[model samples]
Target: MSREEVKLPDLPVPTALDADEEAEKNLTTAPEVPVTPYTPSAVTPWSQDSGVATLTADTAPGTTVPVDDLPIAVGVPEGADPAAIDGDWKVDLAAPAASQDAGVSGMIMRVTPPADADPAAQVSIAVDTAGFADLYGTQAAARFGMVLLPNCVMDSPDSGDCAADGGTTTMSG
Candidate 1:
């Protein structure tokens, strides 16, 4: 069939209202609002601490004792990116190649991040026992119990204390 082209007619435009007439017709007196004077309440200053001895110590020369250094040590790479390392991390445990031990029976990993990080941020962790099956038997890996403890200063989870804030992942293989 042959098709014929159709032309559409132009739409009519709306007329604009007169500025004076529109303003006068829409004008109305607004209700009066009551104004209240602002009066601040009296505030009391915090009291200073009084001098009181809570504990008495009679010191001698040989009263102190020292302990040995910690076993675990964490060293960041010399040129590691700060931003790249700031996040949740997971570690897999497997027997060392050079070690004569049967497999990794137990291991502990400690991670310390830079100070000034947000404490409200969630601490996520995952212990991967899949790698242990290669070195150790699958039964041993399944029997192992994993524990993660995150410590913070003042025991406050909301305080972003990076010095005492670190998480430890331990597995008893």
Candidate 2:
């Protein structure tokens, strides 16, 4: 018995890449971003001189839309490069459930905890993102999230949306 020889498929030669063009295509420089500055507004009179802060102006007529009403940001955020991401990332929000999260691109995926006994839910995200390299912040590490906001988990899941219970957040790290 004789074995038949196998022939390897012919592969095309890769063209040499121009450093300048390659750098440009890789988005070394971000596109122009618009700046929207916040303007100060006049303070409203207090209902009480001293005590709990209460607005004297009638704000009851104002309307508010439900958080659940808004659609999820399933689409990649403006200027985000989904193709740039290529790794599994895990962020421990330390909550019973993953309420909500937003990033440059992709979705938050619930992952099985390393240990079944671990009650804390785990979620997977994507790192190595682009389109936000110009943002103000120190990127000491190679991998970083362009933007991630896992909303506060409410004590009662049935109460309302996570955004509703996330009351009074004046500062964020």
Best by lDDT: 1
Q: How does candidate 1 score on lDDT?
A: 0.33
lDDT per residue as tens, model 2, 1-173: 33567667899999996567445454466788999764323222111111111111121222211112111112122343322321222222222122222212222322222232223322222322233332323332234334433332323433334444444343572
Relative to the true structure, candidate 2 reaches a TM of 0.19
lDDT of 1 at 70: 23
User: Which clashing pairs does model 1 show?
Assistant: none
Tens-place lDDT per residue, model 1, 1-173, is 33465666898999997567545566578988999864323222111111111111221222211111222222222343333334322222222331223122444334333344344432322334443433344355457564443343113333453232324223552
Q: How well does candidate 1 score on lDDT at residue 77?
A: 29
Q: For each candidate in turn, give its C-alpha RMSD to the true structure in angstroms.
A: 26.2, 22.2
